[model samples]
Target: MTRSAPRSQAAELELPGLVRDRVREGRAKAAATRARRHAEAEIAEESPVARVLVDVPLAHLDRPFDYAVPVAMAADARPGVRVKVRFAGQDVDGFLLARTTQTTHQGRLQPLRRVVSAEPVLSPKIADLAAEVAERYAGTRADVLRLAVPPRHATTEKEPSPPAGPAEPWTVSVAASAWAGHDPAEAYLHHLADGGSPRAVWQAAAGSVWPLLLAHAVAATAASGRGALVVVPDGKDVARLDAALRQVLGEGRHVALTADAGPARRYRDFLAVSRGAVKVAVGTRAAAFAPVHDLGLVALWDDGDDALAEPRAPYPHAREVLLLRAEREGAAALVGGFARTVEADHLVRAGWAHQIRPTRALARERLTVAIAGASDFDLERDPFARVSRVPREAHETIRAGVATGPVLLQTPRRGYAAALACETCRAPARCGACRGPLHLTGATTPPECGWCGRVEEAWTCAACGGRGLRAPVLGDARTAEELGRIFPGVPVVTSSGERVRASVPDRPAIVVATPGAEPVAERGYAAVLLLDTWLLLGRPDLRTDEEALRRWSNAVGLVRPGGRALAVGDPALPALQALLRWDQPGFARREAEARAEAHLPPASRLATITGEAGAVDDALTLLALPAGGEVLGPVPHEGGRDSEEWRAVVRAPRAHATALSSALGELQRVRSARKLDPVRVQVDPPSL
Candidate 1:
């Protein structure tokens, strides 16, 4: 048949239509390839072009939108560059993640309104770490992205700050090499030199020197010819550390980043780091994501600090942000705290981080500290918690400490945030649910329970019918008032919310403040007073033991070496005992063991799924996963407090956490394919 084919001269006259169609098909394929390459090159040439994936804060949507970049600004217009763009006919600040040759839009592409000045605000490494954090926390990428950048510049029309020149590179070294044997200051310095940055926890006992302790870490890291980032709890800490670091690194080698700086100044520091002018950065939570170059180490002074917890859209924890970044960038992480948080303990036990703990033997020999009424709450307790009452011994200690200098009093509540009510009606004279106290500060206001959305008619104490009720639990103001009575002549100043900071006291004074508001002892307090030890140690949260221990340690840490601090609880209650002996590492070890045995979250894994019942059901159907996984409530209840819809929760091993999360994410994509509902997904939710 092949040989005879040559004889088909007549058959060689093919149909004109078929021949033309073949030619057109080949030309179309060639044109399609040319179009794709052209689009990629055009985007590469102009705009801060990136397939920006942002979290709009909607419960049900998770995706990225492609945006074009202006050519002249493409140099600094790379991934993690915060940019201004129009979306849904409105302009918003978005982090430019990465440029892409693909797009999901058929509509005309929009160019970035302007680059947010590529001052390297969001480093490439941090950007990747942010995405990973979102994944580990079962949170949205946009959620973490939002965290990586500060509040978007207010206007689409704005001028960029003037540029700053880069500063010379810096180096680090310890002040006292002999200090390393058993003391934490030395231990931490040695830890840094050992390439221990990926993860390390520093647990120092009370009386353990920390400013000097952290200084050692900073110096060691700097000496390695790399960068270091340190984060403290608040302004007082920033001020204190700024002075300490300058002593070693000299002026202008480091920058202090706190919100206290005026807007222009803050922007200047932000740009300084962006321009590599500042090799070392220190600040509160926001500085954890600093964009320093060749970062070799990261440190957090206190891990349990609420200040480290960002309350914005993603709500990422700073301790965690640094932990994740350290691993990803191969940098050392030293979480230095007077007391250890259970979460840090978990990392240590799991071999994810080293427990840089000071020996109890060394701690015990330094200060003879003890909880006076260690076994009895009556010795030191708060009325609000219904624990043992505050004791006479603890009171006496404060009386004694105050004579030498300032007596630091730690309260459990601050601001108007703490309210009181009538115990008989189980309601305090409040503004019904707002929990605002129904006080006659001005006129005779009817007493009501701030909670329950109910107002009492002439709500007088049923027990006494006296329409007046004082705070059931005293706030910092009330505490200050009482301390005034307890020590009539001593000046009583408050250090609670609003009146948060305390100046260094030169004479005998009583500084009654809430936890977290305690000011740095400008001249160092002669003695510290712990009012409600049990109340803090026995709260209802999962991290209660951990939190209580931290607060106590921080309070005790303010004391001068020869000065003393006392906790009023059964010092035998492991946590209090740890306090008496100043044993944070041991306490952390015990807490870590308890957590792992419980198989509860942080030990295992958890995820929250919420959305339309149909979509949730679809996801559940796909997850016939292994036994390590468990799905909790899609039990169908009235959500939104009063809405008619339903929601559910799914918890599983962390190993399969992403699969379950993706199933949920894909369900979202599928649901979005048609319509969406008011569903929310939170992985490793900080709180339910």
Candidate 2:
């Protein structure tokens, strides 16, 4: 049998084991190739782990999330880039906060879906500021980021910054002149130049000189090789500051960042500042967070204007933001206005900031003020002629004052009739459909509901059955019309809202404008008529008197040194006296003292919680307030019809403010985690 088996039989017997070995070798090689491919892909992904802040905008999800960077997106997905990521189960947009080799998140991370742009729209400074702002305002960082950074313009971001221009040093003489008697302001400038962070509140005169003073401050900061940020209330302030900065700091040292300059242009200017191409940044409220490098000084013009308050969830005021920036960056702070705010006064009272003022005699010599209705003047004869909107004294003053320059008339409203009431019963006219108050936008436009925006042709008063309407608040247009008739052949111009003029010719024209819309005359206005003092002072707002004083002071600032201003209001009012005497510091001191006594803001901290009645009540109950804090309301919200929403206020001592903020933040987190209905929480709100 062995002989028959031969060589062929022996080879067949060894074939199974050899074939098995060959199959094992092939399988091993395939496994090795798969491992190598995986290692290569992971090296591409894991090397660049991006910490992205997804734009989910939830309080619970406020922090940055980690994402693995894909191979193709490694270059574009660098820090601060806008990118799209897979959050949860869907794609979401986010800002790439940073890149790191590791993440604390233990779970497997999702990869970035795609890169939106390589342009690092957000700088580290900006991201930090936004986060600080969000914390201070009790808001989600995502919301604050939305306000700090404008929408990304692909075309604009790719474009290069304009070439460098001639370098002309800004003059400091304006600063010296404006701060001549106000030693604190001068010292503030010196401190900035010496690279010291000095915080101050300057009660600068309202007119042309204030802009010059601000420009001087900026120039001083620039002298120290540092940057400056100037935030105002509106575009007009931007233009005014721009002109003054150019005059004092020379051309091309600063860029005006305003929304009025289309998005593309605004983003371009922003990029310039971010890239250190420019040193000075000037713009409206949002510009407080401008990406300025080595910021030396942060200044705000008319910080009390409502325009400075962000109209979004977790509202923040420009003044507070600047204050925060000053603290965070160790930069000098300058908060100046014609009239001082209680908050600013508090800073001086606390010794956190010093007040800069002109000598009483110097201030008196700079501007003259008179009370129109203070004296025993005939309502229908001497000061106020029948059917005439302008008082006779105002008319006379304008007649003589126009010889020197322009005369400014400041009105409270800016249409044919702002508010209407029944002629018989003095009941407000409202729309029949919505029961909203009616207003007249123009002489041609019928009475329209201010809330619902519907024409009330057949409207009837609820309190009175009468239909004849009378103007409760006479507007600028009507005032101009009546003035035009009174002063025949004299040119009358109106400025308000969209039609605001930046500057007026230094001629003998009668300029009528709404608050904050007054045009700067080449030479100061000859006379300023502060009309409708009652209308402004009679508002139910806490800052009514303060705001009125501010408006009056602003108008007074427009007048030449020897020129006069006539205010048509009760002279006995402390605010009116403050304006008449050019006593901003005294007013602020008194205001701060009074607010302290009343346990109001600037002395104490306040937070507002608003939402559906049940939600707000539930949230209030859940709050574990600090020892000195008090919760005051479950009251119906103002300006709502059949509103289910209610508001509750939390008042705390300034010392305990931090604790209160922390408690509120925790409450927000709990609610968010529990998936409960959201409540709107506003700390230091504009109106509240």
> What tens digits encode model 2's per-residue C-alpha lDDT throughout 72-144?
6777777778999888789988999998889888887777778898888799878998887787778888898
Lowest-sum lDDT 10-residue window in model 1: 439-448
Provide the overall lDDT of each model, using Cα atoms, as 2-decimal numbers: 0.67, 0.82
RMSD of each: 11.9, 7.3
Q: Model 2, which residues run further than 4 Å from truth?
A: 1-40, 44-48, 70-72, 170-174, 206-208, 374-389, 419-472, 639-641
What number of clashing residue pairs does each candidate have, in the order they appear? 27, 2
Q: lDDT of model 2 at residue 532?
A: 77
TM-score of each candidate? 0.76, 0.88
Candidate 1, residues 543-604, lDDT tens digits: the string is 78878878878887777656777665555688888877777777877887787686656666
Error of 2 at 156 (Å): 2.2
